[model samples]
Target: MPETTAASSRTGRLLAAPLALILSVGSLTACGPTDDGPHADGTRPSSVTSPSVTSPSASGPSAPGAPSVPAAGKTAGTGPTTRHTASSSPAAGRDPDDPDDRLHQWMESGSIPMNASYHWPMLDTSARLADGEKFLFEEHCGARRTPETDSLARAAWMEKARPGKNDGDQNWLAQETIAAHLQDGKRKASALFGGLAKELQACGSAHTSVTYTTRDSRHVAATIVLDKDTARPTTLHEYLAVVGDNVLELSLWATPYHQDGGNKPDVAWPGPPDTSVFQAMTTPVCPQGKQC
Candidate 1:
């Protein structure tokens, strides 16, 4: 069967299972606040563009009409730009726009397998970026050696050999699955973007916008913005990727004062980093006490 068709079928079965029941209960109760921080009423502001997914067949890195990179020396604060916000909906309710709903449904239906890769995009990003500039340096510099990259590559290979991870499971299957998918040739950038959109929507603020593009005809660019001050208290940005219908990957970034009220003494520097391909990917993983 075609992958989409099979995914649809699996979704149907998942919606009918115990996991679905649990998610339904949790979504209704444990999610987040419901007040629209900046853009309420389910309507995104005019300043922002709706989520977009560009398929591999449509265009590669040099595709015309793709979102352009910010000009050199331009800062994020030079003018108005779209921002991201967390979901404000009650936790127990189903996110009407959740892209992972299908995956969650499948997991609930008991389709989850043991020792499968799970891709957790949001957590992965957050964990990598929690330390700010240090984290950023590692992601872009490859200054440190870690098992995550190799582990993720191995997980990707294993996915074809067995059932993949399920959504809502506490295990790190989602991240592993995404790692595996990124290494897979068949996976497209659009699928990754689509999965990111779903995960962002589930957070509920409706002010977040995520965009991906090719930076300088080489690197894949991922950007997120938080529009509201209220939502900014929790997180400023997150990066995500989709491995498959059931797998997603993610990372987080924030301004220094995003969580605490303590403001930076100097003007905030914004825009993408200045680095090479090898540096950009590993800059956020530098070990503590090491200079990136």
Candidate 2:
């Protein structure tokens, strides 16, 4: 990634953390669209290059002992209300009936509640044809081979800001979702999820611990607390859910201490935002052309 300024350099570092999760996908044979294109098994068109991660200024770290969810019926914002910094709606003129558009809609709506919760201005967002294999395999998160499926659509969002009271404090969160065309949605979901579970297993060690809150055939959720043995630890809550032919990946990252050596924020880390909207991506009715 090229950087013209210190801010861009820092953003790249921060973006890499989330993109690293993409690398864990390994080989996903039988995972992509069967229509004409680069085989989903791991090849990318020569034209498209891997995306670069980027960062922004700072926000305070997660408060010690923050609650993971807000009280029932209440939204999750902890500080005084802040003006919305970004729009969560889909672009105008998109065909509502297009399969890709439907997938984009799912990704956008699922993020609205979360974005509204903490004034987490959207730093970046992307909706593109699925082409993460080359990038994912490069990370080598213990997959035997790279995944081969080209999703019908893939969407990603990055949110970060200085929503804290202290200078140089920061909070970051990201979510990515992919919808594939598959004959057996359940089986494909299970297989891809196995890869994710494997990566999570490999990611745990002395510096970090993984605690799963939900694990089953269609959905999996876990929380990882890092640097727990040391001061200024951080937490990352991860979720994976397969709805029909769509799968959602979300990460809530909270640093309990400032990376810039600034004081902690006055507010607590607002835990994982509600994900029911994402969990329902393919329900009520499947996408126009999807097998689900």
TM-score of each: 0.24, 0.44
Best by lDDT: 2
Tens digit of per-residue lDDT, candidate 2, span 1-292: 2446878889899999878766655333256443336745667455543233112222333345743444445566533232222323222233434554434333433343345545544322334433333112112223343242222111122111112232343344444445343335556655655666666656677877778877776666677776767767666666666665445565555565555554333344445433464444344335546665
Can you write out model 1's per-residue Cα lDDT over 21-95, one digit (the tens) per residue?
A: 888888965664333334446554455332464443443453477764544566544452222133221122223
Candidate-wise lDDT, in order = 0.33, 0.47
Off by over 4 Å in 1: 1-178, 181-194, 197-222, 231-250, 255-270, 273-279, 282-292
Give residue 65's lDDT in candidate 2 (0 to 100).
Answer: 73
Separate clash counts for every candidate:
50, 21
Query: The CA-based lDDT of model 2 is what?
Result: 0.47
Point out where model 2 deviates above 4 Å.
Answer: 1-102, 108-117, 120-125, 128-130, 133-170, 183-185, 230-232, 256-267, 271-292
Q: Estimate the overall C-alpha local distance difference test score of candidate 1.
A: 0.33
